[model samples]
Target chain A: MTAWRLIDSGILRAAEHFALNRALLEARRQGGPSTLRFLRFAPSALLGYHQSAEQELRLDACTELGIDIQRRISGGGAIFMDETQFGWELYLDRADLGTRDMSIIARRICEAAARAVSGFGIDARFRPRNDIEVGGRKISGTGGVFDGDALLYQGTLLVEFDVEKMLRILRVPAEKLSGKAIADARDRVASLAELLGFAPPLDEVKARLEQAFGAEFGVTFQPGTPSEGELELYRAALPEIDSPAWINLVGKPRSDLPILEAAKKFPGGLLRAALAFDRPGERIRQAWFTGDMFVNPRRTIADLEAALKNAAGADVAGIVRDFFSTRDCDMLTLTPDDFIMVVHQAMAQAGPERTRP
Target chain B: MTSIGDCLFPDELFYNVDTGIWARREADGTITVGMTSCACSMVGELVAYLPKKVGEHVERNKSLATVESGKWVGPVKAPVGGEIIAVNGAVAAKAAIINADPYGRGWVAKMKPANWDGEAAGLITGAGVRAAFEAKMKADGLSRC
Candidate 1:
């Protein structure tokens, strides 16, 4: 059986948490330990690795709410992390998994974690490139980083989520989420407390994850503290992570990206969407929609977003068409093309160049 | 030249195949580096790229740049320690260019090697780049391009 170390570090400042991420991954790459760590964030807003703080977040809201804004080593959209969510990170050599394919590896680990999450009496499954969901609502989101043979994959388990807080902390324009927008977000994400009517004990959730990983990888973990080397790196990386420049890396004006929203009355219902486009790349950076539409297998919209993530603007129609073409979802009277038409209507502000035939 | 799984791995450039990165020697004795085609296919369309600044010295096998796809961000390690001379400004402005042409306009950086002779000893070149990649793919249970 493989030996893995388990670390449970209580609530930590955003900088310290991220610093440990860098430190532990480095140590493991240098042959430190095959480990799993559990961490908690001190109410914070974390931006993806490549994203600039000014561009992706609402600094005023975050400051007013007392949410610490930071950056993560993994790539993905910005997220609001707090003690309500539990973070689990895995550090291991690539050889340990027997596959060098990044996507395949992500799927494998996510499936294992989903299995463990399901053990908590809620049905959960791996939703793709990186998310775990229950009934189409995301319960967990994951991402990773690799250096040489070592890899660090991490996920957040939403034990007790706060959708309103998340909406405030994220850069979603205030006017957009005034009333119905808040309800729309509630439809997208779910937490354990919401599912089971009470937050499961944090320790029990950790145990389930540990047991699931143990069975999947055929390993046993002895709960322990990080080694001296990891602590050393944590100490060294803290200053770099805590500074404003590090958080504000790659400052680009938001004017480069304008928020455009559109809607239309269709046979099925009203469909609305807010589009974020990268003019130069002509790709959709992010899209969120809220409307009265009937679709079965409710996860279809989120899955659509997953499929359309980073889609080339030039290929929006093709991407939307292909997405619906590949999936079997019942949207009642609305066709997948209708969803496309509504999103395009929102993108009209970008100009006719994006409205390709 | 060898094409595996439709990925072109020219045997002419020196490759650190495991990392899926390649380095080519320029006429001025500097080195040009870029990600392998396999890397592009695996990561999908790269939407964002941030390379280390020009003039900085990076160690062999360390990050020369970082790229993002599907919100997954990771680094492209340097194949040899050297002074970074220039970065691809075009790719910086439009990252899909790297996925479109990894070896040519997509090249990440130009470097003045600090130990070209010593580091070059470890990197494969000529037909060796293609063969090494072929062997790697075979061992990884991959199909030919």
Candidate 2:
């Protein structure tokens, strides 16, 4: 089998990383080599291509902390990256994947990635949509961008994460930024350092990932650098990706997605649901639950939240009922309908008359 | 509603099989463009859509819009490019419309065709859609829609 080139681009700024994203994608589309690249970023807050900075991040906080803000070519939620985070990406033609379906492409890459992470002696699995998880807690999050037949899928692995620092810069309500809430975030996110008791050598980590991906796609990897053509494309796309106009291209006010909460006393415990509602779309943009509920396998809440993300408001009851019907888990004395009740009560607050001034 | 399995290929619309888009020449002489049902099934339910601004001139095979599904972003290539006169605000707000109604109410953009007679002739339509879509599905490795 012919060896594929593997390039490890050292730590750089956010603007430089995204510029490379554009350059590499366009170059590959123009018939350049399909390669695997590893990259790291200095402190930065990157937004999904169609996301608004105002709705996703604290702009003043980002500036005060000196985190470079930029937009990714991919679609997903916003993220905060620093040197502690490692990023890996695959640039390949759609034909090489044996399918033109984007969802299948993302799944195949993520499953291969999960295999790589499992090499660390953790039980890592690819969660639906785009998350690589261990025991239900996310260790890696993924997204992608494509041009013509060429596509780039990328994922981030947490070497050592600072949950508090992340929550500080994220646009959660200030009151919700309590020490306990930050501690709660740790249950939903995992890091290699915490899981393995030490940060593995960077060389070994990269090599293992390359090996796993190679095994999955039946290709060997060889070290190489970017061609001159790709560099020229990078230079051209840089000014655009790093500009404010690009970062703010999809601007929306914070009010567009408002957080609403409802609390109820169930037979088992007091359950509470706070969700971000998209009034126009009539969907729950995201939902978070916190309470003294006795749900074994703590990852259940996060997984439920993931399933409920972007769910229609009217369909919340059926979704909740349907979600629990399939999963083999214990919710103590609390039925899935208990979750439905709280979620509906909260969405009721988003009614037109209630929001109108 | 003519279909190849669950995917629709309305006889009245012209299709660019390679691009997976449809072009409808409206009575006012403007061309309405949208993704074919095959394109919709491939992407799944879209989460976001960003179309070219109204009044922007685009070239053939260039991007008229981009859609995101499950965090994957890709373009909807223009079949016969011209100035984008209007975009569907409904689809912009709710992208599921494309999957639910790919032919109507989910049209991406409306543009005055640059060369209707010339380009429209190249597109497969009418009685030829079934065979064209059958070969396309076979190449795509899709047994069902």
Best by lDDT: 2
Residue-wise C-alpha lDDT for candidate 1, range B1-145, written one tens digit per residue: 7677678877778889878899999999999999989888877778889999988999999999998766557789899999999998878767888999999999999999999999888888776766788788677666642
lDDT of 1 by residue, A1-357 (tens): 777999999899989989999999899889889899999999999988887777678889988989898989888778999988999989988778877667777888899999989998889999876889898788999988877668889999999988988887787533355657677777778999999999999889999999999998999999899888889999999999999878887777775556777888899988887777665556777777667888877888877876666677667899889888888989889998888887777666777644432
Give the per-residue lDDT of model 2 (tens digit) for A1-357.
967779899898888888998888898898887889999999988888878898889888898899888889998878889999899999998777888888899999999999999999999999878899888788898999987779999999887888887887776532367877887778778989989999888887798799889998899999998889999999998898778889888987777777889999999899989887766667776688888999977788888887887787777888888888889888889989899999989888877833432
TM-score of each: 0.94, 0.96
DockQ of each: 0.52, 0.58
How many angstroms is residue A274 displaced in model 2 relative to the true structure, after the best TM-score fit? 1.7
Q: What is the lDDT of residue A165 in candidate 2?
A: 78
Model 2 stretches astray by more than 4 angstroms: A172-175, A353-357, B141-145
Error of 1 at A223 (Å): 1.2
The positional error of residue B12 in candidate 1, measured at the CA in angstroms, is: 2.2
Specify the poorest-scoring 10-residue window by lDDT in model 2 chain B: B136-145
Model 1 residue A313 lDDT?
A: 65
